[model samples]
Target chain A: MITAAVPERENYLNNAYGIKSWLLTRDHKRIGLLYLFTVTLFFFLGGAFATMIRIELLTPQGNFVSSETYNKLFTMHGVAMIFFFLIPAIPATLGNFFLPMMIGARDLAFPRINLLSWYLLVIGGLFSLFAMLAGGVDTGWTFYTPYSTTYSNSWVIATALGIFISGFSSILTGLNFIVTVHRMRAPGMTWMRMPLFVWSHYATALIQVLGTPVVAVTIILLFCERVFHIGIFDPTLGGDPVLFQHMFWFYSHPAVYIMILPAMGIVSELVSVFSRKPVFGYQFVAYASMAIAVLGFLVWGHHLFVSTQSVYAALVFSFLSYFVAIPSAIKVFNWTATLYKGSISFATPMLYAFGFIGLFTIGGLTGLFVAALGFDVHVTDTYFVVAHFHYIMVGGTIMAYLGGLHYWWPKITGRMYPEGWAKLSALIIFLGFNLTFFPQFILGYLGMPRRYHVYPDEFQVLHVLSTAGASVLAVGYLMPMIYFIWSLRYGKVASANPWGATGLEWQTPSPPPVHNFDVTPIVTHDAYDYSTVIGQEVEVG
Target chain B: MSEHIDSVKTYALVFAALIAATVGTTAVAFVDLGPFSVVVALLIAVCKMLLVALFFMHVRHSTRLTRLVVLGGLLWLLILIALTMGDILTRNWVGVPGR
Candidate 1:
């Protein structure tokens, strides 16, 4: 086993004085928890909007809501979930928290920029809330032209402005992570020795830095279209709406990988830890994250299959789309291989890891259908697309987020969440998630379209089933909110290494010191070296 | 360290070449290259971007991990642009009655 060069405890915990201290702190751990709290609040709010959409879909008519109101509900749901919750949930919170710690650093390279990212998130969220109160936007999250630029009257600018602001937060967070991982590793922590989670975040950060700027420009052009009537996307003004889509998806397509890669990163850690093995093909898994991120940008046009894009372009995109699947499949196979003949444990995190595997597979497979030229044309804007994304975003990303939250809760809070409730919530989330999204896949196949306030009579049964599943999904989401808060005061005090996980964070005290390590640690081993912890008698042998 | 020096020089030369190519492409755009015009401009643009990414972004100087990240972004962009264009361009190719 390799040795850890332990540093002295210099009271990094009590070094601070006020609320302002934490609010303005550059500590990665504190910033991460801060992000966790804020993103969770938005997750619930986003879910509430989703719950409303599903409830309305339970019937054929636009019951319990007007068409305009239904439009706003679904639009806000997409905006909130995509921009406010899922996009930032994993990378900004869990990745931010553990990346530095895992790399044995004091903080991200540019700590002030990190703090700015959180503030930007809060400001963006407030703008969206203001939009909701003033009325609400109904143009859908894609904000496709004609509708977003000329139609739909409910405070589109305020909501789009919020999304625009959130883009910077994403960009800044990406920049900081990239610089830190490059410049801040502890001595002896070579790139190969780093955890797969850190490598995945590094890949994700690259996309955020490069791709988000293009979207920021797109949103600006959108604002120009709405306010000034400049007609960048207005076909009447010698402008092509398709160009807007190209610009929009240019950023957005990569944005999908941005959302999923970090979750894949988190899954890597959970799978390795639970399976009691170093990740199978560590270099390959690490490279695949980057591969997915890079390839992610090329495949944005798949969203425009039935739009004004060319058939040649569609064929090429379909083929390239298939290429991206290869790297993603590589990761799945490697994870399964990692679980081969190991002393596996069924901890809360492990259950979510399994959940991620199953849901993400369904999500990925459906994406293949969407990527195909013939199939996509048949169901371009249908419920199939909706179900396809929700499976990946909600089913895959959110599951991994919660798993990471539960896995790292002890480190963040210095307390244990009730284990029984944690496991039950994971199960509920899995069942409710499948119930909520799976039926929509069939509905799409049967020709039910998305973003409609009303549907045909034939689609009602599946819609009702989907809505019923959403309620269970809500319960699944709510349990963690209840227990995690309850655990803060009443739960048992946890030691530094509650799970016997072999990361640098476990070497620090519970809840960690303000600046993270009192003095920097020197890493001399590869991550997930379970033998080191086992030799110390940390786990139940 | 030797790898770093060689890549840095390579990056610098490519960046200079990119600037020159951009100017040349814009000049050529004014000429009637027809469909080839857009293709040529894009090709030059792609080359310029590659240069910036490889040298300025330090992808070439960095480890294989970094290179993989750069490649990942490019590969995805290719899929997006290519597939979308495929559907749009092929729309009117056949005597499929609707057209």
Candidate 2:
């Protein structure tokens, strides 16, 4: 049957009532919902700031707002998007929702800490919100020293404190996922037997635990320098500002992996389930996530190529940066191979998966471009670098994030989203995303620096086109959000294992019980064991 | 999770040794072994970290996975410090583009 009964039985959602149930719930799934609601707000908040930036750039005269306002807009946009939205987007919401379920555990190892992690994120977000309301920070999200520590009179401390508090959220979430994955699997669910999604989350958790502390410490040192007259980053105070850059990028680079790895995990599940095949080189894809995490740390120096960092260090970083691409390439090749001659279905989720592969490849290749010491010299602080990261984060991660959201929405909500609207929005997002960022690559190549309110008239046409695309992209983003909400009440009910997919998650009822399963699943086959999955209605154990 | 548990005696001895190391680190500070001073201090710090991890944190009695994670954390910490210090120390070394 294509549909099943509306979830009449008590589930996680129906099992609770009132704001108190959500605000203080110990269920990982409930906390995940709490995160979903919160980060979605931050996403649009970031998007609104992005809208102002695009509108201001429409004619390239900086006429829409003052240069100072533009700086604040972009800074807050980035601060909201990166620290609050993207960093926690998939992990906090979807990962929190499904990680325990996918591994056949009752919940995360520490359910109370899971709820605490969500609270920390909210508290941290409030700090940033307070900063924004009181005339936003002007230093870019990178928060480079001297300008931030010595010169700027913006709300640097408030925003930095917000991020500092949020870093613990990341750290605790990672700690919870790691310990859970290590100890919580059901019988027969060994490491290799586990889903790639779990593997990717495991890798991301490692990065979050190990890398976030560095950034937190850097923020603390920044706070000390700014609030107290300490010289840690203030040049006049015998502190070296370049050291601040070193420490900040040290975590920020790995933080990039922290964003993409979970999304990559989502793609692994999408490609396998829709194609009706096991992942090609499952082990390679799993290890690639780890490779990216570890290698992500070694390459932060590449960001310093145009800085005061030594040429020798930059060269080593340049070389190591290319090495990180090998594992990424392996995953890309394996996914493409997974689709070869398989019964591939271009559902909404699969469509997004395809977009992820194509765009992520473009992003990863451009990464190699900037990895070159000479090439990065030309494009440093330019729109090319901006375009490159938007491709990775927006084009790549957001696409997979949407794909994962759609793939699991049935399971999460017990309702199937309107497939037609989902497909159209997927197409719109693809076209709109390309339209928005593609020209920036050209404009950057043509020598337009980022963070400038005004630019040469020669760059005006590309800027206009980019603005037009941003509007469309904004529309594309809004559609699923509207439809996803619409689906909750009006949409068709979802059957257990509606997609007929493998994994312990699909075995239980849609939206599952508060305890997750009627019985603990004993996994007897490797993940994506299609023989057991196809032509079979998955029954609750 | 580890089944093995340490007795109070083991904990007390480890605690005493930790105190001794703390005093030794300060005492060695006055010796000033030139280039080796920082290295000596760091070695003692490493020992102290290991002692805390093995005994107080119970890593020594924990599962292999737990010990590996502790070690990974230490390795990652080394990477952060080493790379940052490497860049700082090398900035003034004064070398050519390609030698």
Candidate 3:
């Protein structure tokens, strides 16, 4: 009997042990895991605030918590979710893990700086956590001026400082990615040969490096105004409150692309892999990411349409806002076309990708509605705007984040999670997410405002539905957490390429070795090359 | 990959010009050039920025990509300020009810 030899399973996981190795290691994979644990904690922390907010809104009355407490809860939720969790979610964790691997590099250009970025995030997270424990901030994540500058006594400075510190983490990570992509690609991994994930990240890093500083400056100015009684953002002084919005949105608007573009990159990979085809219009999809990033910067004025921003500026912004959607639409169309005449699988990741396409379409279309000057005047601060963003952020980004996580879980951990449970959870999340946020669109159309502790009684039914959906959404999010943890011990060991995908990462062993590859991989084919993958699958099986 | 190193003489000359520009800025601040003061001051500032970017930042001798990166940052900043000024400059136009 001929026996197949089993290779030794020494990898990043078994290469080191104990806390110090993890805490001080410059290995991007370990650093990615560090980020994973940190951001996961913050995700739940943010979710808790969201749960409280939803429960309180279950009725028209502010019974669950005081109005002041409610404000802090939402603010904390936004700050934790955006700054600590969403902003760093995919990029810090998956990007940190796979970028160097995918690009066939040993590590990011600046591995120590990558580690420092995580520390900065932790330090930043601690400041926000302290602010929360010390009574919390009422200024919403936007930290809009006048209220943030003059009124509302809360831990605004500490929270702002937390955000300020975290901004550097983003900047450092961006700089590392920029340099790595520029300098560290494998010998033959030319610009067009690189995966869409790298392209999207390159775009995201651009926004991160170029756009994040303005927000940091804005926050510093806000801190100055709040602390030293400066009038930079205060209307009572010589400064203009609108100026704060200008600077704030200058960064914040592009920040939305930062959150979604990576998700788009993930979807591009998942769609191609599960469909067993090269991405349709691959170059088009790649350039679309760059187009979205560049165009994203031009449309910040759309957010200021109702904020005493000039009609002329609003027109330009609204027009540009509509323009940005073209690239997004191009991506959506390309993904759908990739599915044409392809052997498609309804795997968990593909299901989430499908969910992303439908939900992101709704979210993107609603964004267009809000971009219109006439429609925006009515729904600017209403639940419509809230729903629109949730549809994009939660529906779009989180869906893709979870999808990417599930798709890469086998590779990341060298084990297969129970597939049935994963699929069920994906379904639950999709249904629950829609049930939760869809009603808010209707409520917003009915003139129901957001950030209010007490709403009119007419909106009670929608509030109850939303709260119920929140509970379901909570379960959906929790199920994967439990199963993913459980899989670590009981699941079957994953093979090198569980999905039969085509990428440098899949070419390496599951839970790849410390340096990722035993021999450096030289790419000879474009990304998503399924021709050889399909033929190889038959012989292997 | 190797960069061109600027000579000390060139550096000294650029430094001296920056100083002269700074003094010109201060002197112009004292005078009332009205609207042109801002224009003149911005022009001088732009010149100083160009000098630093081209020489100090090494864009003059760096790869085209590096030059593009610097240009990209400037272009984005211009977009932000210019579009914002469009709003601020035209808020009272047509006399909307809220205004």
Candidate 4:
């Protein structure tokens, strides 16, 4: 009988001795671990706020919390989740760790800047946590003006400050990834030879570098007008409030692409690997990621259909929004085509990939509905918009994030997560997620508005259904937290290349070395070259 | 990885051109070019922008990839400002009823 034989001693986890080593280390892998730890805490904090919001929505009346408190709950939830969690979720952690490794580099182009980006995120998170603890902001995560500036007396500046500082983290990370990809590839690992994960991340970094600062400038204008009377977004001082929407969504719209593009990249890797075939139309999948990033910048005006922007501009934006769906559709088609006539595996990662394709398709189709000027005018502020984004953000990105996490778990932790438990959790999360958000699409179509805790008697049943699903979703999320921790102590030790994957990352030992590859790799084939995995590259397992 | 150094003469020429463009912008602002006054000033500004980006910012010595990405960012910025300004300026274009 064959058994796993790779030694796990003296890895990056064991090379460092104390807390100071991790905090001060420039090793990309350790920094990835640090991002994983901090990002998970923010995830649960966001999740807890979401829990409270769902619980309150269970009944027709605002019985769980007061109206003001509900406002704070959703605002903090969106702020915690969007800026802190979703924007940096896949890229900062998984992409930070794996991107350098896959490209056959020891670290990002500037290792110090990589560490600085993590610290920036933490400090930014602190400002947000301070805002949450100090009475919470109520102007919505969008932070619309006059209300954010004048009327609603919540911690708008503090939350905006947190968001402001976090934008630098994004900008720096984008700059780092762009430079690293351009300069740091191993010999023969040309641009096309790099994995789709790196390709997607490259696109994500571009958005971060170019788009994030727009929102940063918007935020600076936000509080400047509030505190210094800059007359930018405030209407009482002759500012157009819709200008706030323009600058905010300029980044925020592409920001959604920032969240999902890397997830799509992960799904690309997962589909190719688990299907045991080279990705069908690999070049198209790679270019599709870039196309989505580019087209994503043009469609921010879809958010403004009912904001009373010019109808002509809205018409152009509405037309452009349909174009983004093309590149995203290319990705889904290729993933499906890759699976066709291939030796497929039912791994937990593949399960989430499947979940992502179906739900994202639903989300993308519904987006076309609202992209219409006529339809969006009716359902602009309703639960339909909320459901559409949740499908993409939650159903799409989070599913792909968890899938990537599980796919790379053995490489990151040197232990195999229990397959049975992981599969169950993925199933639970998928089912619970649909149960929760699917009804909201119907609720919004029936004209149920979002962000309001109280509603009429008729909407209670669907609310109860959603709340019930949220409970199950909570259980689904909690299982992975519990079992993943349990796996660290008692799980089977993972072998290098346990999945027989073909990326350069899998060429190294499980958990990898402090500098990733012991010697720099010289790539010889494409990213999905599974034939290379069968002999010399395959270690004992 | 070799650093590309520009000669002082090159730098001096670029600086003189920038100063000349600044004077041209000011001179254009004073002219009664009718509706084209804004257009003329903007044209001079664009020339200044190209000069600074190519010479002062080192894009002239940078890699082709760097030049492409820099162009992409500038084009995207133009999209944001121009499209947004277009949206705001055309509110009256759709023919409202009252006036």
Candidate maximizing TM-score: 3
Docking class of 4: medium
| Residue A383's lDDT in candidate 1 | 91
Runs in model 2 deviating more than 4 A are A1-7, A536-541, B1-47, B95-99
CAPRI accuracy category, model 2:
medium
* DockQ for all candidate structures vs. native: 0.33, 0.59, 0.74, 0.62
Model 1 Cα lDDT, one tens digit per residue, B1-99 = 455555566656876798799889979988998889888988888888877887677677798877876776676556545654555567677555554
Give the Cα lDDT of each candidate. Answer: 0.85, 0.92, 0.93, 0.92
lDDT of 1: 0.85
Q: What is the TM-score of each candidate against the true structure?
A: 0.86, 0.94, 0.96, 0.93
What share of the reference contacts survives in each candidate?
0.64, 0.48, 0.80, 0.68
lDDT of 1 by residue, A411-460 (tens): 88888888899999999999999998999999999999998868899888
How displaced is residue A527 in candidate 1, in Å? Answer: 1.8
Deviation (Å) of B58 in candidate 2: 2.5
**Which pairs of residues clash in candidate 3, taking residues 3 or more apart in a chain or in different chains?**
none
Off by over 4 Å in 4: A1-8, A535-541, B6-56, B97-99
How accurate locally is residue A264 in candidate 4, as Cα lDDT from 0 to 100? 96
**Residue B66: error of model 4 in Å?**
2.3
